[model samples]
Target: MSVHRVYLPDLGHGDFEPGAVLEITGQEARHAVRVKRLMPGDVLEILNGQGLRAVAVLGESRKHPAGHGKTEWAVDVRIESVAQEPPISPRLHVLACAPKLTRVEDMVDQLSQVGAAAWFPLVTRHTLTPPKAERVDKLERVAAEAAKQCGRAWTMEIGSPVPLADALSRTHRAIRPSARLVIADPRGAPYSPDGSTDLALLIGPEAGFTDDEVDAACRAGAMLCSIGPHLMRVGTAAVVASGLILNAEQPR
Candidate 1:
């Protein structure tokens, strides 16, 4: 099994110092101590999941380093060091229809694995999945779990599920002019791939965008684009678009 990268907010104080005892509690402790069966001297990396990481050592109990036949585990972890990484480049944000339950969860997981800056759930005309307010927490958990599995230094940010029209209006107001917007149409014209520094990719449901939806997106400055000859699943299309966006952004 791989050494899990656990994300805990209070890994250390203001200036992260190496070798400071980090206290792990709740689910994290259960995972590392009970489930993981991690013994003293085992090493794991601790991430605040906001771009900071530290190496930590496991210890058994408050009175650690016990000899003889006693085995109560404690996270007597000392952060080796905290190295902050640069933020994700050319932020690739995704806007997609809210798919069904299992599908949406999988999409969120896949989106995090593909390094999207944020996932915005969209409700379109043909969107069959009713946006569940309570599911936001479920989505967040999926994102965090997926990020952990993928070694991402940041938890995937999930925006509230909004109507497609409202989402477009908000996008126009929220993003800068240079932020390229691309809509996946399967029938759209090919766009120049060079203008993707901070991109927003919009994907419709399996039913594709309605005529009105297309027109609205166009009015809102979204360029129509295609992902080549084959039709792809909503989740697959999002991944492909994110990859294309990441590749198109110019190297700084």
Candidate 2:
């Protein structure tokens, strides 16, 4: 059986090689000691949430200073081995208007598990909810928790809301020549899976995209693609479209 996995946010991009020592503190520490009931000699997998994971054995537990005269548990771990995973292929990027706040975490969580490279809340003609920095920060935490459960070495990247024009411009500049841009539309071409290494998918809001918005996106090089005849909710369409694209990229 695989060991339980935990995410250590402060571990950063390096220093997780074999034989390294990691000190996990704060809420992560409390979860390990108090919730998981882990103690010295316990073994678990640790992830840096940036494509690196390690097998680590817990060392002695100690009390660490917390804010406002509070104290929290802390733990030390000896890293046994570390491996870095390459980013997922098809490199799926979903750009959409923000859904209801109640559904944001669920949307982020499932998308991370499905291996989306990033999620961008787009500001569009009919965008119901504008992006806020705090909400985007919360989505990051959601992605991290989802990654921990799915054993993903890397967490999904979340972006603050940007205008559709700016988002399209940035995407165009960043994507490679081989990458494909797709917009989800009911009257568009049927989604035929391809083996492209990178894909950028655009999904509109509940009210749908304005014709001008679609025209701008298409003019900027997005191919209109349809999920099916039936309309799907924003979050559902995002997950379903991603899965379809990824399934197409898989070896038959």
Model 1: weakest 10-residue lDDT segment is 167-176
TM-score of each: 0.85, 0.88
lDDT tens per residue, model 1, 150-170: 878777788876677765675
Per-residue alpha-carbon lDDT of model 2 for 1-252, expressed as tens digits?
A: 567788986776577767878788877788989988887898999887888878999998899768899888888899898888888777888886678976878888889999898888877888887657877778899999999989988789997666788656754443445678888999789787767888878889999999998888889888788897799999989998888888788667
Clashes of each: 3, 0
lDDT of 1: 0.75
> Residue 218, candidate 1: how far off, in angstroms?
2.2
Model 2 spans > 4 angstroms off:
65-69, 167-178
Candidate 1: Cα lDDT at 155: 72
Instruction: Report the Cα lDDT for residue 121, model 2.
Output: 83
TM-score of model 2 (CA atoms) = 0.88
